[model samples]
Target: MSFWRAVLAIIFPPLSVLGKGCGSFFIVFLLWICGWVPGVIAALVILNNPER
Candidate 1:
């Protein structure tokens, strides 16, 4: 992930993964609603995926 994306993921997980896909965005958004850490983790995983 890029530096800004990493930072964005930490600050706002769902937004960071917005370009990933609708499914990913929703997943991160839901995880964000549940808790902060999960959302960040999900965003990072999705963003880091080479096959996205």
Candidate 2:
């Protein structure tokens, strides 16, 4: 993940993973609604995905 992306993921998780895909965005957004920590974790995982 880029430095800014990592920072963004911690600050506002969903936006960090926006370009990852609709599915990824939806997943992170939902997790965000549930709780910010889960959302941050999800965003980091999606953003750091190896296949990207």
Candidate 3:
């Protein structure tokens, strides 16, 4: 993942994954609702995946 994206993921997880797809956005959004840490973690994991 790019440095900016990782920063974005840290600040706003769901927004960072906006381009990934609807499902990913929703997943991150839900995770964000449950807890900020989970959302950030999920966004980073998703962003780090080479096979988007």
Reference-based TM-score, model 1? 0.97
List per-candidate RMSD values in Å: 0.4, 0.7, 0.4
- Each candidate's lDDT (Cα)? 0.96, 0.93, 0.98
lDDT order of candidates, best first?
3, 1, 2
lDDT, candidate 1, 1-52, per-residue tens = 8999999999999999999889999999999999999999999999999998
Which residue runs of candidate 2 sit more than 4 Å off their true CA positions?
none
| Candidate 3 lDDT for residue 21 | 96
> lDDT: which is higher, 1 or 2?
1
Query: Candidate 3: deviation at residue 43, Å?
Result: 0.2
Candidate 3, residue 1: Cα displacement in angstroms equals: 1.1
Which one wins by TM-score: 1 or 2?
1
List pairs with backbone clashes in candidate 2.
none
Better of 1 and 3 by lDDT: 3
Query: Per-residue lDDT of 3-46 in model 2, one digit per residue for the tens?
Result: 99999999999899988888999999999999999999999999
Scored by lDDT, model 1 comes in at: 0.96
Error of 1 at 44 (Å): 0.5
